[model samples]
Target: MSNKPTCRWWPLAMLGAILAVVVLTWFFDGLKPELRLDMRSLPPGAGHWLGTDTLGRDVWLSILAGSQRSILVSIGAALIGGSIGVGFGSVAAFFGNDRLRFTLRAYLAALLLLVVFVYSIAVLWPTVSSTGHVSVGISILLALIAFVAIFWLLLRRFNLLRSRITFPLDTITQRFIEVISVIPRLYLIVAFAMIIPINMFTLIVLFAVTSWDVMARMVRAEMLKVREMTYIESARIIGLSESKVFFRHALPNAIGPVATQVCFTISGLLIAEATLSFIGVGVSPETVSWGSIIHGYLENLQAWWLAVFPGICIYLTVISLHALGNDLDRMCHSKH
Candidate 1:
């Protein structure tokens, strides 16, 4: 009895309680985040529990309303990203050396080229559409031609080396991870936000894409270690298919850490969403989120509740999630 508050039970109970309140609030028929000009900046009292915003929106109700979508987005992104990351990373670790050996002339190179071209097009669209300059258009056309020329030159060079040597997929994957991990994920999401419309689905897509790398890297490391384990060889010798061995044996052994990683992923995505919403590009204009509530208070510090309550909500959710994740991570390591 060191008096340390290390129990894992609290987070689960706390998260459940919060979610219950949020869900019930969402379904409550009478409560809505309506604007009232006359009721501006009222303190917590008779009717409103958490006070009012500059727009006269009920702070408590707004937080509940925002939680509806915010929680949904975080959960959705976690499930999708975790699934893809763990699945691919496990498989990639096992079969990487075999399946990844290809020539520079492989269609894989062509596919990379296509990806680059599509990204370039996306980047140039706003500029071309907003300012519509002939010189700019001509310059873009020339750049595209240069890209094509460079692509052809690389293809030819790669083709020449196809017979002499094959491409190392392990190297390619590692390089990709390094490159992606180095770039700030928020910047990528912001880039996409500029090009595409922001909505729940869009946010989910963005989070899924940005959030998977950590899980993938973690799973890949675990699977690689598990790959060398004695039982994995036995499974293979018994004629189990790669997929079956992976899911039935390797994945189960390796998933505890990755599973815990999901908690952190959810926490991270929640923060990311809030950051984006604060910047005014997160959800659609009509939709409200925790970040949007805080954003509303930037100009009007007098309405302190606008920032404080939602900040409390976000702090509780994020910290509870992190604490749970930390406990889970410790449990996972202890078992090993």
Candidate 2:
């Protein structure tokens, strides 16, 4: 029994560790460790605390340098995911029990299609204009195909609404959340990572896209509770606009759960990024991440420092984020 509180509180110390890592990484961001062929696979010593990797880059320095991108990607993904989840979840909460002409799945599909459209243009325009690649035509054609598919779905949705068909938005959202939850995130990662070049941008977009549904579910639940509160009603009765009411009052009350969800998302993303790097699917080969340092261990087991140090970084970071998330979740539940 005495150990319970100690176990619970110990993770708080990790908060300091995370802060230190962030600061260290930021300080060293512009200083990437160069390859030292003569010093390859050296063990930890005065010159190199974590030793050198197969490429002879200082392992400790590599971890610190790579950490900046990984940590930033996780935080960026969580922020973007949280924003999207809050928007969608709030909209669902507003129309909740009332039958709605629109469905979340349709909404999601349309939104995704629009993103694909815009992203494809941004990516292809340069190639088509300058390089004139045959692949650009194929990409443009594919984008058009995706647009047509979404248009068909929207057409059917229009027909249903025209027929006076309506659905309980809450039920639709819950079922949509379940479906999104079941679509194995790793599968999406593999599918996209294989097709698209994996970099900081792609990783952030991938992590953000896959992480939002759970957050949306949490936000929706919180919003439901907040909507029934006396203060929320008072705001509405005082002629405050719905958007202002939600942004000013409802979002604040509902933000706790979303905050907890973001921490969990970050924890999961850190592990995922490491796993991707381990499998050689992360950022470019030159990009030295903690996982990339650990990847060297597979080559030479004798270089144990290659794996151990970076592994410690990943493990400690994930643990810190997970523990923090658990604490936040507990606090939110207890207050509710």
> Candidate 1, residue 86: CA error in Å?
1.1
Candidate 2 lDDT tens digits, 166-196 = 5577776778778777887767877765555
Q: Residue by residue across 11-86, what tens digits does model 1's lDDT show? A: 8997898788667867885656888879878989989989987778788888878887778889899999998888
Best by lDDT: 1
Query: TM-score for each prediction?
Result: 0.78, 0.75
Which candidate leads in TM-score? Answer: 1
Clashing pairs in 1: none
Worst 10 residues of 1 by lDDT: 161-170
